[model samples]
Target: MSGSRIDFRKAKFLISAPDIAHLDEHLPGDVGVEIAFAGRSNAGKSSALNQLTEQKGLARTSKTPGRTQLINVFELDEHRRLVDLPGYGFAKVPLTLKKKWQQALGQYLQERSCLSGVVVLMDIRHPLKDLDMQMIEWAVESDIPVLALLTKADKLAQSARMKMVNEVRKHLADFGDAVKVEPFSSLKGIGKSKVLGILDEWCKPQWLMDTLEQAEEE
Candidate 1:
C-alpha cells in the first residue's frame, strides 16, 4: 500500500494462544503491529488466512465447524504479525466456553493497542449475517478498520460474485470508509495480492518504512 510492499509470503507461524496473555509472552515486551482475522465459525476464515500467508495448513482448515478455538498468530518479522481469532456462532461449544471467548474477543478488540486492523471473513453466499455484522461493528466501534474478505468466491458464478461485493459494501456504507469488502477464495487463490497489499500497509511501521525507502534509494 502506497510505495511500501512487505511480502506476505515471508510470513511464518508465531504461536497459538487461547487468550491475549498467552500471545503477549511471544511478543517483545507487548509491542508490535498486528492484523487480526475475525468471523463466524464456518466462514472459512482460517482458509483465507492460510491463503493470505501462502502457507497451507498454517491456520488449520476443518470439516467440523468451530474447530479453531485458539488465537493463532503468524509472524512476518519481529515487529509485524497476523492474528487468527476464535470463530464465533458455534453451537457445539459449551455455553460457558462461548462466553469466555466472547469476553476475551471483546477485550482484545478494545484494549490491545498493537492491533492495527482486522480482516472480517464471511462466506460469499451468506455474506454479513448477524454475527458478521457484529464483528465488523466491534472493530468500527474500536476505531479499527476492517477488510471484509468474502471467502469461497469460487463457489459463486462471476455475476453473483460482483453482486455480493456490492451488496456487502452497500450495507457497510453507513460506516463510511472504515470497512471494505472483497471477493476471496482460498482454494482457488483468488484475491491473494489485494489482501497482501492491505496487510503490507498494516505491517509497516515508521522505522520499517525508513528501511524500505533507504533500500529503494540504493
Candidate 2:
C-alpha cells in the first residue's frame, strides 16, 4: 500500500498554553518525530491543525488575533508531536512583549534539534508579509524542512487560488523546492492529501534510521 494512505488519526490534546518549550517539556521524552505549525494571528493555524489531526478542539480558536500567545504542543503518539506556534503580525500588543515572543519563538525554531519539520501556514490572499518572511528566513537559515499551507483557499476563486499558490512558490523559491507550497482549506478539505503526505514523510524518524545505518557502517 502507498505510504500516503497511512492514516494519521486524531490523538488526544496533551496540553495547551502560550509557552512553546515549556509545553515541549510536558511532552513525551522519547518523541522521535515532530512537525510544528507557525503562522500569523487568524491565519487559521489552529483550524488547520485541528483538521489535519481529524480532531476538533485540539487547539483553541479565536476571532481575536494573537490569542495563542504561546506555543501549543499536541502529542500525536508515543513518538510524535504536532506543535502550534503563537501567531505573529498585528497581534495588537506591546512592542517589547512582541519582541520577547518573537525571540522565544526564534530560539525554539533555531535550536530545537528534535524538530523534524515546520508547516508554515499562510493566508491565501496575503501569503508573504514581512513577519512571515522573517520566520521563513529563520527556517531557511536553520536548514529545517518547511511546508507552506496556503490556507483559506475556499475564500478565493479557483483560478485566483492557483495564481496565489504560484506566487507563494515564487516568493519561497529562494528557500529551495524542498519547501513544499500548496493551497489548502480545512473547510473545503482541499490539500488534505498533500499535507498528510508530507507529514507521513517527516514522521518517518530518519534520525533513527541514520543511527542504525551508521552503526552498520561502523
Task: Highest TM-score: give the candidate number.
Answer: 1
Give TM-scores for every candidate, taking all chains together and pairing residue i with residue i.
0.90, 0.87
| lDDT string, candidate 2, 1-218, tens digits | 12233356655667664555566567655347778889988789988987887877887888887856787777666667787777777457899989877877777777677888888888999888887877777777777788988999999999999999998888788778668898999898999988898888887765655765677689
Those runs of model 2 whose alpha carbons end farther than 4 Å from true positions after fitting are 1-6, 209-218
Candidate 2 has its poorest 10 consecutive residues by lDDT at 1-10
Find the 10 residues in a row with the least total lDDT in model 1: 1-10
Candidate 2 lands at a TM-score of: 0.87
The per-prediction CA RMSD against the true structure, in angstroms, equals 2.7, 3.4
Distance (Å) between predicted and true CA of 8, model 2?
Answer: 2.8
Candidate 1 to native Cα RMSD, angstroms: 2.7
Query: What are the clashing pairs of model 1?
Result: none
